[model samples]
Target: MNIAVLIKSVVATDESVTVSGGEIEDTEAKRVINPYDEYGLEEALRWKESFGGTVTVIGAGADRAAEALRTALAMGADEALLIRVDERSVDEHATAKLIASAISQRRFEVAWAGHMSVDNGAGQVAIRVAELLGWPHAGAVVACELTDDGKLLVTRDAEGDSEDWELTLPAMLTAQQGLNEPRYPALAGIMKAKRKPLTELTPELLGVDLAGEEASPRTERLGCETPPARPAGRKLAGTAKEQAAELLGLLRGEAQALKGRG
Candidate 1:
């Protein structure tokens, strides 16, 4: 019943961001666990509590990213492992490969992670790792439980509804928003995390060939531009029927213009 949770360090969602030289400036921005990943970590911790097993938190990031793993330990994870990478040069492809390689050496029955990263919004890492491991996978999971027969009973969001799935051991799952409420680290747990095991490893240590051209970043950002400011709102005046007619005309005109542009 051992479980592993893939963690990511991202700029705080509420913090202001600046795009410089095709990358968001994060040197000074406060870093935290990806919100969705926190849900997955919480679910893993709960599963460990219920099933009596170890829970390990793993991440691929620069050295500073160890703070996020320490935070996970503070929240009750049994241990932490960091797959070190250069923050500036690494992309999702390299990250997934590095993580998959690191995970291949670990012994566990389940792996958990967020559906996507807040900064990149690319929800491909967990699925790619699952594929690399040749394991069954489910994504955007909102609810899950371990049944008596050693199977996982899971419910995942499919658009507005949910899809139920049952899987055997060694499965990967990505947490959605409604999965569960994440717990904050208490004083005791925080102190305990200071002493909990936190190991760091490089891609080469995992037998990943990052020096090869194939391991290089597959995509690059040219630049980032702020979205154009929205147009100001206007108030419609006149009798109810007159206002309705005017609004309908405006809607029709707007739709027609957009259609023409398309």
Candidate 2:
């Protein structure tokens, strides 16, 4: 069971976010392992413990992203691979391409990643990487098991429901919330992680063509603005009938305002 887990470094949620030129200015923002990706790492570590194999953590980002990989290593991953993308901004497509290329060079039975990164919340990279590798993908997986006949039994969230699936090896799975509680790195593990093997690769080394017009992002952000402040809640201070009538009146007023805008 040679498992590979994808981890991402994300801006801490408690920090205030500031956008500049349609991008978040996060140069000095406190960074941590994406909360969702932590589930993926935890699941992979559990699999390794059960089946007895190596777990490699893979990531694609700038240099600072190595810290997240280090954290994963501290959490019991055997090795870490950092696909260093020189560009400041990387879309989901490019990220998938880079990671898929790196995974292609290694022998892996399964690839795991978060359903979405907290920073961007696109939730597309794992599926896209599966497409690039021509493998089956199960997203939002909350439970996973390896069967004797070499099949993956996974339970995943389908909208508000749960679905069970059986997939073959070399497949991809995206971890959702409620999968498992992520374990914190112990002091001994943290110390060992400093000496773990961490490899860095470039797009050229992976034979990925990141240049040319075709490689450009399919979508571009025109601009970004903060959402309007939320209005205060209003208490209905009347009987049921009166409250219903007041709600209807408010709805009608909102409808008329929309009509006027149109």
Candidate 3:
């Protein structure tokens, strides 16, 4: 019943975003655990309480990522591991590689992660990790239960409806909202986190190479800027038929503008 939960450090939702050098400049923003991952972490902790086991939070990224692990430790994770990398140009594929390599060294009955990160919103890491590990994975999971025959049943959100999925041990689940309300780190928990076991790792130590990433990033960010302001609404100043004609003309103009761009 050893549980693995993947956590990530991200800029707080309320923080202002700044773009610099064709990338998000988040060095100065307050860092916190990604909100979506909190649901998965809470579910993992709940499962740990129901079935006796250790919950290990794993993360890979810049140095600030360790902070997210420590926060998870305070929230009742038994241990944590961080694969620290200095690169800023990492894409979902490269991150999946690093994380999957690290997870391969651990033994666990199940793994959990957020369906997507707030910043990236790719919703691809957990599925990719499951592929790398050769395990079945369910995304947008909202409910989980253990069957009598030693199987796990999970409810997945498909748009507005849900579908139940049964998985064997060593499966993966990406938690969606409504899974569970995560507990905050209390004063005592915060104190205990200082003594919890935490391991920091490197790519080379894990037999993964992240060097020369600038030459071949799976995804590229050419530039970042705010979208132009939206125009105000226009009121048609005419009778019913006249207004209809004006609206039709406006739509035709917009279509022609789109055609010109294409």
Candidate 4:
């Protein structure tokens, strides 16, 4: 089985996020693989180990994203494909179209990616790619493994419960966390990754026309505002009756908003 893992280069989760001029400033923030994408990569690596096939990690981002792709190679992907894009200027649909174009040229039995990106958290690329490929797709997958006969056994969270299904090959799956614990790259693996094949692909080569007519979402950012801070609570230095009355009043006032009766 040939596997392709989609990854996104995102700002480190620990960094404080700031938006300036309608764009996120992450010039100095550390970049890493999306946490859920790591789970997808680990799952792909496991499949490769069992089936004796190649695992390729692909990403769309600025040129500096090669570093994130290299990290995937260090984690045992056979190859890496970097699709550089100025993410700030592209919408998810265009990004997905580019990825789908690149994937169309690859010979793969399965594709994997995160359920959503931490930075943008759009959660649309995977599904759109699957649609473009006309393949079976499963999203928000919390657990995945290969069956004895090579089908995919997928478990997902749905409607407050977990569900499982077996899917045939040539499918796209969006991975969620808790699927499996990802292994850290050892020093030896990191050194060997330097010699691994890293393919840099352009949008043109991938048959993606950035300027061509395509379906993209219409969005307008009117303004940005911080949420109101919570009000300070008062300490009740009275009997339980006083506390009960205060609590009832608070509930009646705030909870009534839910029913539009405020």
Candidate 5:
């Protein structure tokens, strides 16, 4: 079996967020693989381990995105592909199209990606890829098990509920959180990754214009401003009933303030 995992480079979670010029200012930020995508990559590697197959890690973004792909290789991907794009403003459809165009000719039995990205969280790229490939897809998958006949048993977390699904070969899947504990790259794996085959391709070569993003969402940001700091909590050193009454009065006062009557 040949499996492909979609990986994305993202700013570190602990980084202080700042918006400028209608985009996040991350020029100096550290980059790494999306944590959720790491889970998907781990799942793909596990399948490769059990089934004895090749795992290809694919990423679409700036050249810096190869960092994420290298992380995948370190964890045990057979190969890596980097779709280098220079621009920063890319929509979900264009991103999906670029990736699909890259893998149109490659024969892969399964394709998997994270359910969403930490930065965008659009959750549309995997669906669009499945649509482009004319294959069925399941999103929010938390677990996966392969049968002897190559059938995939997948599980998804649905808020307070969980559901299981069976999918045949040649399917696209978006992995959700809780899929599996992602394995850390050991020294041997890291050394092996240095010798792994990695290929870089440009979007233009794929006959896709990743620059033009056509779709726009209903909401647009006029400007980004930091939220006002919350006021310090008030001290109510009194009886329990008196403290309760004070809290009630505060809530009512906030409501009246919104109504221009406080």
Candidate 6:
């Protein structure tokens, strides 16, 4: 089983987000492997351990993104490939194109990625890559097994429910949160990862045309603003009857306001 896992480097969730000139100033932000992508990496590692094959971690981003690939390496992936792209030119479609092009250069039995990237929250890249590769794809997979016949049986999250699917080899799957607990990089593994092969590539190297007018992003960002600050909670005072009355009053007020707007 030659497995490929997709990973992303993202701004740390706890770090403060600073926006400058319609873009997030993330250059100085603490970076880490995207939380959801970690599950995909772990699943790939598990599959490799069971079937005995090399697991290659693939990523597309600026130079700093290599650190995330290294982290995946430390977590047990055999190798890492980074597709360097201009930060401004990287949208979901462009990213998928670059990743698909890079993967096309190698032989892989299966591919895995997070259901969505935390930074952009655009859950379309992995499936789009599958489309570009003309391979079947399953999203939000929580469990996967290789059958005796070499087909992959996967259980995936379907909103509040679950769905099971059987796909042939060479398919792609996006991992959900319940897939598996991600393993931390051990000290020895961390040291070993430094010695592991980490290759970097560009769109030119991959024979991808990123310069044409058709390469422009289909979607445009108009602007970005921080969410409004949450209002302070109001504490009710007095007996249950008084609180109930207060709640009803508040509801009535909201209803009247909505009616006025209508």
Give the Å shift of residue 83 in candidate 6: 0.8
Q: Ten residues in a row with the worst lDDT in model 2?
A: 253-262
Clashes of each: 0, 0, 0, 0, 1, 0
lDDT of 4 by residue, 1-262 (tens): 8999998888898997666765566688888889999999999999888888899998887766788889999999989988877776577888888889889998999999998999779899999999999989988898888888878888997857899988888999988878889989989889999999988888888877777777343343454544568888767556899888777676678656335444
Q: TM-scores of the models, in the given order?
A: 0.89, 0.89, 0.90, 0.87, 0.87, 0.90
lDDT of 5 by residue, 19-94 (tens): 7776667878888898888888888888888878899999987767987888889998999998887535556777
The residue-level lDDT of candidate 3 at 77 comes to: 96
Whole-model lDDT values for every prediction: 0.89, 0.88, 0.87, 0.85, 0.82, 0.88
For candidate 2, write residues 118-221 as lDDT tens digits.
87798988998999999999999999888999999999999999999999988999999999999999999999999999999998899877774544455556
TM-score of structure candidate 5:
0.87
Better of 5 and 6 by TM-score: 6
TM-score of 2: 0.89
lDDT of 1: 0.89
- Candidate 1 stretches with Cα past 4 Å from truth are 235-262
Q: Candidate 5 — worst ten consecutive residues by lDDT sum?
A: 210-219
Q: Which pairs clash in model 4? A: none
TM-score of 6: 0.90
The TM-score of predicted model 1 comes to 0.89
- The alpha-carbon root-mean-square deviation between model 4 and the true structure, to one decimal in Å, is 2.7
lDDT of 6 by residue, 1-262 (tens): 8999989999899999877677777788899998889999898888888889999999987777899999999999999999988766767778888899989999999999999988889899899899999999999999999999999999999999999999998999999998999999999999999999999999889877776554446677787777778888889999999998887777669545334442
- lDDT tens per residue, model 1, 1-262: 7899999999898888887766667688888999999999999999888888999999987766799999999999999999888876777787888888888898999999998889889998899889889989999999998888888899999999899999988899999999999999999999999999999999889888876886778888777876778888878999999998888777768645334442
Which 10-residue span in candidate 4 carries the lowest summed lDDT?
A: 215-224
List candidate 4 stretches off by more than 4 Å.
215-225, 237-262
Better of 1 and 2 by TM-score: 1
